[model samples]
Target: MTATCTWRIWGLEASLTVTDPHRLGEARSIVDTIVADVDRACSRSRPDAELYGRSIRRGRPTRISPALCTLVDAALDAARASDGAVDPTVGRALVSLGRNRHLATESGRPEQAAHADGTLHVGPADHTVIRRHGDMLVVPEGITLDLDATAKAVAADLAADVIADEIGCGVMVDLGGDIAARGETPVGGWQVTIDDGPDEPRTQIALQGDCAVATSSTLHPRWRHRGRSMHHIIDPATGLPAEERWRTVTVVAGRCVDANTVSTACIVKGAAGADWVAATGLPARLVAADRSIIGCNGWPAPDRLAA
Candidate 1:
């Protein structure tokens, strides 16, 4: 039994598939519930969202919902593990880059601008703690934290897990291009197409049960600003758009959150990102700006064109 449904959520076209014939509606309902919950939990545009409320209060320890708390903990852990390369406190920088508004509906083109100096302290998970000091204002009043980098992947993983546990069937959650799957459906693994642009398409990826995949690229929806083309991925160290050494990087990991974390880190790491991905023993595909394709040792190349 095969059924598919698509809708807009988390700033992208989300699609779900369930192999159980009798549970099609159930699967779609579960996906809808999860997407709504994720929107409530992570949306920065909402005035009353926990993150937005916390951001407005400025430096005070605001209590967050359990789901958001979990995401924050995951993000902070990733930041520590990646040596601050995947910092979540770059919200201010993102806003200054004209991403302060929601991307899903905002039609204005990307614009770049210099940002004020400041630092934000996230938490010990128990309380918001100011771990360091910097010149920039800490937590600008009314600032919104965009979890575009990680939340959707987290939602996909969570939704897949919950659906499988409750319905006793396989589940696949695709939030934009980030995906998570549980149980089984496809014979070899879920076939995924990697798109770099119209002219260049690469091999399909086979993702198996209970795994997550995420891709980060400097080419998507990017625009020129101040004599330089800037993408959404920002380098925390420089407080600027990351240098585009690699056009795209994809990572497969044990969890969607980890995949999300590492994929974003790869963009900032540039050419060395491929070596770092290799050292982790995780499968990865890297497309350089020069159009060279590189994959981890075990990643299979597609027999036919991916497009």
Candidate 2:
């Protein structure tokens, strides 16, 4: 029989499902340790985090831990893959839009809808200040490094790998909406429910084999600043929240990091996102502000496959 556990850490909810009931406790411990380690290393809210420490260096590369280096590389890869739409260099932009701090500290609901009323401000994308050379990294002075977009997803992938390899069993880890599974999956695969609004019927999808899924939405974490609407997902081209027709996008990929990267970038891509998603050949489901749905790539037909 399989066992499942859920806990809160780093201001996100994490769920773990393990194949061996006997190893549940051990698996949870390992996950907890990994989560905390990743938070310390990646979270920009933590002034003591490695990402923050090295991001302040202006001209010189600072040596980082192998694990941190990997995370940084993954983030950069996401930026490159999405043509800067899912930019890691948007830390300054995020902070200016009031997403620089830990969300839990100033929270209403955990995932509040992100919207704004002011004119969309267009600005140039931030220059790439983050550079990695071997195990060292560098960022210009005064540039903040916010890994909010990819760190949790990467952590989920890492935790799932750790649980399956060390515990010698299958496992699934969900950090917020970013999910990853390895080893054996439950019968019919791992079912994932997608919900992205204050009140909306949920949709379910299944993941078979070694797979991951992630959702990015503009309806969550929304707030108005100085009478202007703002959200966390920043368009690198314009340095503003993407005024996309779709409010939410869900994607399935071989890794949680990749899924998250695409989902987020799609939001920034706006009207072109559906075609871009199709071009990438990743199955995706996109929901518009009015709740109309569009399926792209290989997203399952609604109601054809029961979750």
Each prediction's whole-model lDDT (CA): 0.68, 0.78
Model 2: residues >4 Å from true position, as ranges?
A: 54-59, 101-123, 126-128
Q: How many residue pairs clash in each candidate?
A: 3, 6
lDDT digits (tens) for residues 176-256 of candidate 2: 889999999888778778876548646888788788999998877778767667777888876577886778999999999
Give the Cα-based TM-score of candidate 1 against the true structure.
Answer: 0.82
Name the candidate that leads on lDDT.
2
Residue 134 accuracy (lDDT) in model 2:
94
The global Cα lDDT (0 to 1) of model 1 is 0.68
What's the CA error at residue 63 for candidate 2, in Å?
A: 1.4
